[model samples]
Target: MERELALEFARVTEAAALASARWVGKGDKEGADDAAVTAMRVMFDTVSVDGTVVIGEGEMDEAPMLYIGERVGIGVPPEVDIAVDPLEGTNLVAKGLNGAIAVLAASPRGSLLHAPDMYMDKIAVGAECRGRVHLEAPVKENLRQVAKALDKLISEVTVVILDRPRHQQLIEEVRQAGARIKLITDGDVSPGVAAAYQDSGVDILMGIGGAPEGVITAAALKCLGGDFQARLWPEDDTEIARCHEMGITNVNKIFTMDELAKSDDVIFVATGITDSFLLKGVRYFKRRAVTQTLVMRSTSGTIRHIEAHHDLDKKPLFKDHRIKLLGE
Candidate 1:
């Protein structure tokens, strides 16, 4: 993959965040998602890559999504596998809550795992804990390993998990293991990636999250020189059959970071739609909306935080909406 494409991905996610931020606090989840998807699709055309959507929206429910197998980009190459979550936390955006983001991951063809959209049991940590945490390991044991690796006491290591009923037992074990917990609702991508950054105050991340998001997380961790592990948690026959259709015969097999994002040149980019410890959300100025994005490259092991100022008038359709109060 070309290193140049890394910045191109930032534009793609920035467009999505910029478009969706308009609906913040409107309490319209689907509407916000639609806005984001539309913006992302438009930006993909400008990036020169022959891309295939291995992981996209619409797999969680019947709602419209950037379906799997969808082709994006201008038909150019380094033929790539593309995965996107235009609006990672629709509910968060709809409620004007923090943790909403627009994320995209791209890798050379056959480099990214075509994970079916379903639940995936995941465990992630920074480079310090790499080769220590395992998905099959007991929850407390993983936390212990991370705490030891980070040179923190059992009570000091902080683990982040999605705030859901499904994670009750996992949370309990973490608590019993004496590690702190950060329970989040809706978005896992930020926290998952944040776990790999020591400054992020997130030492570990584990739980069942969307498999598609898992692949995206793996890409980011790969670039950050972190460790991530996951096992497909297919809920039923439908999801299992879907996995088989993708030629995944071992649904229970654990996937390491290298397997999930196989390419040495994977690119991961994400623009925060709402505030979080990892990245700041989009901020609207007079005539432009400023977006903060995180871009990473696995080949070079570089991570960048970009702040872009957009010119609303140049946007395709939201010119009026974005610059309405600017009086242009």
Candidate 2:
């Protein structure tokens, strides 16, 4: 993959962030997601790459735009596989909460996994503990290992997990291990990204989230030289059958970061829709909207934080009186 594709991919997420930021706190999660998908799909037309959606909203029968199996971008060289979450945390954006972002990843064709839309049990940590954290290990044991890797006491290590009823036992075990927990309402990608960076106030991420998200997180962590381990959690026989159809014979087998993202020739991009410790939320002021984005390319080991200022007047998506209504 060309290194320049990182910036081009960032443009796609930035457009989605700019559109979705207007729907923040609107109490309409679907509306916010719709705006983001529409804007993102529109912007993909401008990029020059032959991209296929390996992971996206849903399959063609389920989602109208940016669906799985959909071909994106103009027909060009450098065929790429894409994984996208137009709005990572729809609930966060709806309630005006934190940690919502627009995220996507692209790699050479046949690199990213076409993960099914099902739950996956994952354990991700920064590069310091790249090969230390294990999915099959007990929660407390994994915590102790990560703490040791970071040179921190068990009491000082902080773990991030999604706030879900399915994680009740997992949460209890972590608390018993004496590590602090940061439970987020939605979003699995940001926390994984945070865990990959030492200064992000997150040391490790655990518990279950969307399997497709695991692939996206793997791509990001792959760039950070971190590790992600995942196992398919089939809720029912139907899900198990789906796994087999995808040629995944062993649903219980754990997948390493290399297996999830395949190679280091990958690019990850995210634009914050709400403020968080990792990236700033979109800020709109005087017909001008500012956005903070994180872009990474594993090939060059290059990571960039881009803050873009857009003149809303020039954006056809928000023209004349439309910008004022969004600000209101």
Candidate 3:
């Protein structure tokens, strides 16, 4: 994909963030997600590409827009695969917590994995520790190698993990290895990407998250030249059948970065709906709404941090004067 594609992808993320921001602290997670999905779908119609959603919110029968197998963007140049998370952390946005984002990644057709909606056990580290950390290795061993690569004591290396019951054993292993643990309530994708940047204060990301999100996070890591490994974790026979339907025969297999997102020419963009480590949250004021976004290209390994200001007084797309009359 061309460099200009990054900007186009950023536009999609911006639209999603803007729409979701309106529902912030509204105590309605589903409303925030719906707003983002609607706005993102509308924005895709204006982009110049024949894009297909290979990994998205749901399958064609499940989600109305931005769903797996759904075609996006206007027909034009650069036929590509699009993976999107219009609202990565809906709960976070509803509660006005941190690390909610609107994220997207695109590459040439057939470049991204069409991951089914299932759980995936993932382990990721920075490029420096590439080929050192392995999903099959014991947790302590992985931590030891990561610490040695960074030239830090085990106690000083901080591992970011999701705060879930499934991670209980993994968390205990990290602590046993003398590595510091930072458990987040949700949104492992941001933490997975943050692991690649030293300034992000995240050294490694370990544990299982949504399989679709694993691919999304892998795309960003591929752009950053980070190391990532994952294995599908089917919770039951239904999930196993879903995997089989997706042509995944070996459910216990591990996937490397290349296996997740094979293309080097990948573009990943994310706009923060709430503050997190990699980007700041949208800030609203009487005059304007400000948002921070990060756009990255895998080929050049360049990440651009953009802060945008939108004049809220201006007419928004799909604005209904009737809503104002109703005090909405």
Candidate 4:
């Protein structure tokens, strides 16, 4: 992909963030998600590529837009695989909490895994520690290796995990290992990406999250020269069949960074809708809303932090339609 294409990905997430911020503290998750999806779809129309949604909200029957198999972009440049989470943390946005974001990653056609909407057992680390931490390894052993790789005390290392019931035992083990633990309410994708950034203060990420999110996070890690490993956790026979249908025959198979993204030329972009470890939430003033975004490209290993300001009093993109419908 051209260098300019990375900016387009940023624009998509920026639009989603701007739209979703309006629903903050409104306690409406579906409405927040809908606004983000609408804005994302509209922004994609202004891009210059034939983008296919490989990992998205749901299958075509369920979601109105940004659904799996849905096509985005303006259909001019190279065809690419698109993976998106219009609103990564709906609950966070509803509660006016942290870790909510609008995220996307794209690559050459067929480079990304068509991750099914299931649970994935994931482990991620920075590039220097790649091939050292294994999902099957004992928790203490992995922590020891990571601490050694970073030349830090085990007590000084911190692991980021989603606060879910299934992770209770994992949390206990990390605590027992004497490593610090950071439990997040939602949006494991951001934490996973943070594990790769040295200044992010996240040493590792381990837990089960949405499979599509695991792939998206892996894409970001790949761009950051980090390492991630995951295995699909099919909940039942139906989910197992779904995995098989997606050409995943070995349900217990483990996937590495290369296996997850399958390419080096990838782009990942995320705009924060709420405060999180990596990015801050949008802040609104009397007349403007401010947004922060992170955009990264694997080819150049460049990560850009973008801050934008938009006027709130300006007419929205759909104002003309609403006016015409009301015969104003």
Candidate 4 wrong stretches, greater than 4 Å: 58-65, 313-328
TM-score of 4: 0.94
Q: Write the per-residue lDDT of candidate 3 for residues 1-328, one digit (tens) a residue.
A: 7788788878888878977887778887777787788888878888999999998874321443467788898988799999999989877888888889999989999989878888899998888888999999999999999999999999999999999999999999999999999999888899999999988999999998888889999999998888999999988999899888988888998988898898888999999999897889888787578889999998898989999888755735435321121115
What are the per-residue Cα lDDT tens digits for candidate 4 across 230-285? 99998999999999999999999999878889888999999999988789998889
Q: What is the lDDT of residue 31 in candidate 3?
A: 74
Global lDDT for candidate 4? 0.87
Provide the global lDDT of candidate 3 against the true structure. 0.86
For model 3, the stretches where C-alpha displacement exceeds 4 angstroms are 58-65, 318-327
lDDT of each: 0.87, 0.89, 0.86, 0.87
Worst 10 residues of 1 by lDDT: 319-328
What TM-score would you give candidate 3 relative to the actual structure?
A: 0.95
Q: How close to the true structure is residue 281 of candidate 4, measured as C-alpha lDDT?
A: 90
Q: Which stretches of candidate 1 lie over 4 Å from their true place?
A: 320-328
Question: Poorest 10 consecutive residues of model 3 by lDDT?
Answer: 318-327
The superposed Cα distance between candidate 3 and the true structure at residue 71, in angstroms, equals: 1.1
Q: For every model shown, what is its TM-score relative to the native structure?
A: 0.95, 0.96, 0.95, 0.94
Q: Please write out the lDDT profile of model 2 over residues 157-264, one tens digit for every residue.
A: 999999999999999999999999999988888999899887899999999998988999999999999999999999999999999998898999899999999977
Better model by lDDT: candidate 3 vs candidate 4: 4
